[model samples]
Target: MRTNKQVYRSGPAATKFAQAVKVGDALYVSGQVGMDESGHIPADLAAQMQLAYVNLEQVLAQFDASMAHIVDEVFFVTDMQDFMSDAAAIYAARQAVYGAEPAVCHSLLGVSALALPALKIEIKCVACVAHESESHRAKASR
Candidate 1:
């Protein structure tokens, strides 16, 4: 059986594939890269990671969700050695993005390449979104 899904698309890849898709309480986000809306990518890994998180946030916002809703994530890096060398800066940028230690399952993998060779990293996420009513009730309880 097919499941009903809500899809969101934007930027250059709009016709390529949805940036995110929601089915029930779960939102599946596609791999987000450091490329900006104008297709500019930074050479620094940390800068790229920071931009990628911003892109991820935009995708989540399309679903009325946020990074807090994220339950799992995967990071695909083109160069593991280079990534590790800059891991501190990258993680620091991530911490700034999340505002706290993110509570989520995470995986990091070294990949040979991404859709764009200039891209050093891609971040994919899965989020658990509460229904409107449930969200309201939770806020009320708090």
Candidate 2:
């Protein structure tokens, strides 16, 4: 028996958690908070959301994956009321990176609190390796 499970670390969170993982052709990214390169959460929800999504995209790229490969995404926001105000901006940020990629299963959750009060948003994702099926089939044929 064998398994394919690899852990990856990136950015300021290298010590916090393996930012991403690959298990049997599936990529699971841990929740990413909205923090800047200097590890500070911005004061605005829109800013925070943009940073969080950017962090997710950059890390995914390191693994040869992109938002287009994403199958599931869970977004956590601090205030549903306030989130509404910046939703358009946040959406724009995501679009800037993802472009016209097919929509992935998504959930927007309003939470009373996040990892920190200053952190306005967090994003977690599960994606399929674009080559997963082909790799699995090739391995089986060998």
Q: How many residue pairs clash in each candidate?
A: 0, 0
lDDT of 2 at 92: 76
Error of 1 at 115 (Å): 0.9
Question: Candidate 2 — worst ten consecutive residues by lDDT sum?
Answer: 132-141
Instruction: Give the alpha-carbon lDDT of every model.
Output: 0.85, 0.78
RMSD of each: 5.7, 5.4
Q: Which residue runs does candidate 2 get wrong by more than 4 Å?
A: 11-16, 132-142
Worst 10 residues of 1 by lDDT: 132-141
lDDT digits (tens) for residues 24-135 of candidate 1: 8889999999988888999988888989999999878776788899999999999999989878877877877888988899999999999988999999999998764344
